[model samples]
Target: MPKPRGRGTSAEPRRTVKASSGSARARRQGKAGERAGAKAGPPAALRDRQERAPASSRARPRKAKAATSLAETAVVKRPAAPEKRAAAERPAAPKGRPPRARAGDQASAAPPKRRPRNAKAKSGADDAELSPPRPPELDWDDTPSESAEEVLAQRWAARGEELFQQLEGHGAALHEYRADLKEGRFVWIAPNGRVSAEASARLLCSWSCATSVLVMAWADPLVSGAEIERIDGMPAEQDGVDEQGAWQIAMRAADACNAAYLYRVSSPQAWYFLALDGLTFSPKRTSFHPGAPVGLVLRAIGEVREAIASRAEPADVVRDRISALSDSLFHQARYAYRDTDWVARLDRTGSCLSHLAKRIPRAGFSAIAAGQRIDEWLERELALELINALSLIEDEWSLFG
Candidate 1:
């Protein structure tokens, strides 16, 4: 507690100690405070009171507050706040109207206000600047930030992001991770549930490609109407297809394509234009289809004579013929045949095609290059004889199918 100063009985006003006027701090501090008060403007309570005061009193503008290191040393006079003004200072009401009540009178009649929690109360004029502070709980404008998990759950969790599903029988799986909320990006988790940029990207791309292939099978001519039913029967989706599952999808697509293609050139009746469709020296259409041995051999000879006839690459043609005979599908079809003559014909045709495949040049032969540019060596009479022989053998197999 501070010691009380005694007052004289003569009713003299109280006197206080003063700092030396010449002190450097007193001069600096007075100027600093004067500048601060000028920049800050009047406090809210003082502004409200000023607004209600008579215009005449407001006309007499108050001087800026004085500055000093000690608040006590600062002395300045202000026009009385409207709430503190006497009744004489107010403007009179118009005729027939009762005198208007002042804000101070109304406040005096109201209940004393409650103080905010956590804010300490103090006595004195410090209350003029910042008293009756608001509690944080009552401030409705502020928003709270959520954690990463909470953010994902709120925005991106229709189907939970951290999903898991096994891919076929492979050890690899499609899994997930929490989202990156700041950038609004979702990372592709690796097959093993680890974060790896390269592996994850590769997995993502492979899955995308295989899914596209499977979807494209619906549009491919290779897939028959029956195959479309199988596609429809597939499950809606798992968590997400992983690398292994994508491979399996791609394999099914391949099977559909291969199965459809088998009938493309299966028999003599389904003959694809071997080379004669539009490749003759004089391009002309003929209604008559080529019949076995003689007619097929004549078309083959015409193809060899032409410089621009599309020839099947000998290497590819031979491999296909030999693989067909030894492959499972062909073996099953062959087992169905009880006629020894048909079986013997198949064996004999396979041997003939295999012999022709071996005759193609091993070195300096490129299917792509040969197709793009004319093959000078293949124009020879020997290559012509081989091409005709292939046609004759293919004609025989066409009847077998």
Candidate 2:
């Protein structure tokens, strides 16, 4: 038992075995770590990420709950509707006279006047010859004095309402006629049936032309330049009396009508009541995606990518620039979650962004393969995605604060 060399020297054998086993385990662990490092690449610092890093990499779970709590507290609240603002604080009356009738009141209003006998008789007449009929000759004692402006306004509105009604009537008649034809019931057709339809159609066309001119006369100059050009350069009909001059006169008349309407009705009231209803009302539902804005920028970047992908050699500079822009947008949208301290929420959004990036090119390429322009489809897809995203944001705004 005197310090045996090969045998146990008290705890010597146990210690030796333990040391050997520990070294073997340490070697195995080092090899495993090396392999893992090779597979995973180098560890990335969260703060050291480039401005345009892939969305997923950038969107990480917050390490501390304090950051999230602060974010929840930091939400910017939408301003409350004012308790009361002076008429001055209120937005200016939509640039014109108020409407003569509210939208809902149209059905109950007095019947509009029919086409003037004078207009029917003249067919085409000079403005001087087509002077409007004088307001019913009234005794000063019996009637309140009306300014020329008021008189003209009243007459124009009456005519506009009449025209709108006539258009509606004609549309209904056309539908009826088509139905009858479909049913094979051509019996007992009146001689004047077709004539009447033709006349109404002509009148409707004329009214539309006149209304367009009238609308432009009062149109806000802020309307797009293209619309202005379309108005100014409208094509002239051969038989219509000095078509250019007639349009000009009609435009001026329209301004007067618009002034009267603006003075009477609110913007929302006018849009709902007069103009849109005449055009027909078929409500369509539109939707926008939550991640669309970033999608568009990504698609545009993809175009750059495809360009880079093409050619005999890669254009690294161009590719890098485009990639940077795409990445920047992706990063911006992803980083927004961080501002809100929604690390968990952002993780999902980042995944969506990455998915969108991948899908854009796939969609674009698919379109190209299907005999469509890839760029065209890519841009269009991007637009749709943006619309979807905006819609989501709007919904969220409503849902949250």
Candidate 3:
């Protein structure tokens, strides 16, 4: 084995002192020079190799060296917690919107935003007053274009002036007029080219009832630009169902017949119910469809459809609509579905028209009673219509039920 070099050996021309030891010794010397003014300063390590080094070779006094050296070699232990720091309480963060980016940027990299110069310094009801105003108009869907063909049954028209004269008193003495109409020779022509030369009075009455429903539709109307302003989130009409369209349909029928002339007679429908007091019966109409049961319920149904399609509307809004529709359409409105007798209500809707027909002539004695009866009849009719419409979409209950 080769011999190891001895400590402080000068046998060979090689350095014995380590580079790290020399650097540490130089650092100690520099520290001692910096602490020379202190009363407790220690003497420098003289008569060593450090004396040969150049004066300029001394390292500068460093705070890091002192702290590290004290930490490693000397330490004054601290308590588990500092008394002064524990005594002082830190303030909570301020509550407000975080800093926002400048215009053209919606990020948080920008500086904290300051309140507007005009912002109110105090908070209370005045804060609400300072808040941004909501828009006056709601975002409603566009009304659909009217189609050339209508979605409803055929418009009511007389065969001739003779038929008009025969049923001139149909609104008053509907029964006598029906008897007269029953005795007459008639030919029924359907839109699909079907001919019924021997159509029964039952068929005629059913058709007439359906036609009267068209009158009901005309009296109330459906989705129109004016109506849209009042109805929030309603689907556009699929055909001629709105005000102008309904007027056109009614006018076309009026041109072909004289059904509107009956209002001139003393009847239940002539005053306060369908016709307004002091209004000319000449193409008489109502602008307030929300009051009309058929119109309101139909519009509410449209709103439900819109709620279903967009789903942006809250469930509570849709549920509220259902409750309102039930109140207007059904006899006994209840919030809970289980609480209602849906079957009886549905049956009442179909049979209420008969009760209405019976009550119309009797209404000659009491216009007030007649008005109430008409309201009831309208509710039933609306309910029946709603029932029919909902049947096709009942499966979508999870969305808008």
Candidate 4:
């Protein structure tokens, strides 16, 4: 400011020289202090602190220094005891995190502590928490399999078998008699005319008595008065006995007898008979005669006797008989009655028999049970009439002397 300083001149040259000398002296003193410190070693307080420190803490610098030396020498050194103890004492890192490694101690580090295998929760407990509960087991027993009707039928069949065994004991004689009658070898002459042998008359009388017993046992109590009168008034010569009239007469007598027999049979027995009839008997077109009813009665008696002798269940047998009776009646009615009033009566009787034949065992014994037995006197009188008729025959030549 006093006078502009010249470009190459200084106002304090001597001062600048003095500052240079001072800086050189300061540098020389610092060097001498460093050399003295090297000879004397560290201060007493610092050395004492280093000696008192834990081995784990004290080995840190030594390890660093060794690492530097190894780098310089291109060789590796084993970790010191202090470094190993420090690594062993360190806590294991938490799961999902890596342990922090020292700057130059990566190789000296201990293996990461494995989580204790037994320390984890039990596998069963974990599964219980994650899965749904199990279902209970089922019991298949105690379940009903059959319908009520089926159970009833089975019981009825059992009962029927028991009854059949009881009835079989009385059938042997009847079957033998029926076989004898079927031969049709006997002949008859008018009463007071040329007579057959006494033995033949006795045999014929016996057959007539057997046939009457069966017919009386089987006769329906509901027989129409008109039908009874017609039968009672019939002429011995059969003047009106054409195919149609013969059918009507035979069917009327047979159906009445069949109805009575069915009434006497048990429900189970009846049902069994019906099933048998369905299997064995079907409708057929055929001729009818005065002797047709007798033939049918004999056939039925033979079967009944056979069944009784064999101790066979009667349900099937009875059912078949009823069906046969009904079917026979039907064929006769169709052949004999066309659209006449007798057709209706025949149809009704046939329907009654058909119902009996088709009945199941749902009602037990009450379904087909018979009412009271026929009056004893009436039965006796009918038996007497049959015997008398057999003794006289139209041609009384067959009568015993």
Candidate 5:
């Protein structure tokens, strides 16, 4: 501004002057502080106080702070004792139990005290007294106790007695056969003393003669008064006029009767009567006119009659009889004339007999009640089938005649 001083020279001189003034002011302040310190030398009390104090306290507060921090770090780094840690971690005791002694304090430990049994019972009684009383209940002291096996045996014995009574009744009916025969009936004697007219005297005689021949094939018995007459009355031998001829005539007589009448009169009981009559009357004469086919049929009919007469006979026996009857019918059918309507009728009758025989074996007889129904059905069906087969035989005989 004054003369546009030289750029580098003027700026350097001003800097130099400022630096010198700052150095001089600094040195003066330093001297003044030193002098003031020398003039106020340490107070006597402060000097004594300083001497009495610890040498460590005389050091910087930062150094003392660092020393204290090192001590705290050592304390923090140290681990707590196991016993103290366990004590701190242990759970508080429940209100009901006393405080438990430590496991390590075995000397202080004792067995836990228990209330006496009588005291416990008294407490229970007290509690019951506080509660409402229960209602009275029935006592079963008077009831008789039975063991399982004993009860089972008793039940079986009772059932056996009942079954025996039923069997006796059935046997009584069978035993009445003699009386029925005396009244001119084979199965049952009606209250009115009327007998089925389906079995005429001549037809019965012919059937008796045929049955006698069958019986004689198996066993020979002594001939009697009526037996002699029946044998003498038999016709002379001729073509198509033998035991088979007698059977055909008897079958024709059966066909002439009502279906119900035929079924009733041609029952197993009636067959039994015929067998008994032949055995008692013409056993010797029957042996003379024996035929294998006729004997087989008669034997099967006898078995069926025996099964009906005796309730104790097992179902297998009845089944065997039915099977035999079917077999006999089949064999008889083979003798039918070929290319005739009778052949078809014989086949149908044989099929029905075979079906009935098979059905009898399949029928269940586990219980008496169930067996009774099955037996009834079998009896009815057997009577109907016998009637049908005999009717077919009669028709075949008529066609041939």
Candidate 6:
């Protein structure tokens, strides 16, 4: 029992050895525990417990409901796929059978029957026909007639005038109605048309009472252009004859012409009668004998023959007077004389007279001849005086000296 100091140290060593052995034994036991747990089964850890259960042969059953989210505990139910119904329950026919034929099966099937071709074509054509055509559009920049309608109207109007000119040139009658007053007849010269009786009577009336020579001159062949103008201008003087006679009418017409002549000197055609009337005597161009009775006679009646009776007459006067008288005789002989020899002589004389007349002024001669028409008695008397005077002058010139 009483303890020693050295013994205390020895005991400490032993205690240290013992403590080491105990720590070794403890580590071994721990390793044995880990090996036992591995051999036995999964550990009692959270992950191991959860994974240990058989997924398909779980002991508990899930509730019949729709699953909401994967992370959440909630569950949900899913809808199933739709199924087909029996054919009897459907309204439309089933797919196996062909579709029922149309109600108008005969019309739709077989060969389509054609109507009469003409009738079908006509109906189609009628349907296709549209409204009447409109007028053509005009190109203002390029077309010749900017406004076609206006140009057409102008052309239509001008066509008539052009046709008229063409007809006038070729189809118009060359010789139309010509009145020969001396012959008392109207002659119409046309290729085919007949002259009307009314026109004939009118022409005859115009030509009536004219001299035979005048008729031959105007009606024989082609009438003179101036003569035609005269005929046209001549108005019918016979307007229900009054008691005074034709002389009064003639005087009145003559007076009117005389009055109108003053204003219309430029238009000689208007005053043609002035030269024919004796009231206005033109001055003689050639000088005759002042004292000679022949000159006096010539001045009064414009008779060339009377002028030739004078002695010491101017050469021009004598020549002119002789030439005029010779011309008158020749003109008379042309119609009166049947002999060829006489015709030649008349022609020669007429040529000489023509030359003289050209040189001399004819106004005086025309006036004297015109004066005779003032009175019928005067005309006859002057004509007789002219013949006597001419005869005397001719006899005196030829027989004397």
Among these predictions, the greatest lDDT belongs to 5
How many residue pairs of model 1 clash at the backbone? 1
Q: Each candidate's lDDT (Cα)?
A: 0.36, 0.36, 0.34, 0.36, 0.40, 0.35
Give the per-residue Cα lDDT of candidate 3 at 373: 42
Off by over 4 Å in 5: 1-214, 217-306, 309-312, 336-341, 362-401
Candidates in order, TM-scores: namely 0.22, 0.16, 0.18, 0.17, 0.20, 0.18
For this target, which candidate reaches the highest TM-score against the unseen true structure?
1
Candidate 4 lDDT, 1-401, residue by residue in tens: 67556656667343343444433544454444344434556544333433354566333445443433343233223345897888888877988987777867888767798976755666667887999988999887887789654664455446446434433443321111111122221121122322221111001000111111122211322211211222343332233233333333333333433321110111211110111111101113122122223333333334433433444333444446556656655764564344445566556655765665554232345543743233212233433442343233212322211
Q: After superposing candidate 1 on the true structure, give the runs of residues whose Cα lies further than 4 Å from its correct spot.
A: 1-341, 361-383, 397-401
Kindly report the root-mean-square deviation of model 3 from the true structure over all alpha carbons: 31.4
TM-score of 5: 0.20
Candidate 2 local lDDT, 116-225, one digit each (tens): 88886576567547778677975669565896556655665676676446646645333211111111111111223332221100000121121122233123232222
Question: What pairs collide in candidate 5?
Answer: none
Question: In model 6, how many backbone clashes occur?
Answer: 9
Two-way lDDT contest, 4 vs 6, winner:
4
Off by over 4 Å in 6: 1-181, 184-302, 307-346, 351-401
Query: For model 1, how does the per-residue alpha-carbon lDDT over 153-205 read when each residue is reduced to its tens digit?
Result: 34322222222221112322443322221222223344444432211100011
Where model 3 places Cα greater than 4 Å from the true spot, the runs are 1-165, 168-245, 249-303, 311-324, 331-401
lDDT string, candidate 5, 1-401, tens digits: 65556656655355443444433544454344334434556433323432353455323244444443343344334567899889878887899998866677767678679978899899999999998989899786976688644564455446446534543554432221211222222222222322211121111222222122232111222112212123332332223345444444333333333111221123321122122111121112211111223333343444455444554345455555556555546544453223334455445645655665565535454544445445433455555554455455444435433
Model 1 residue pairs with clashes:
30-67
> Candidate 3 residues 201-239, lDDT tens each?
111100011112222322233322211112222222223
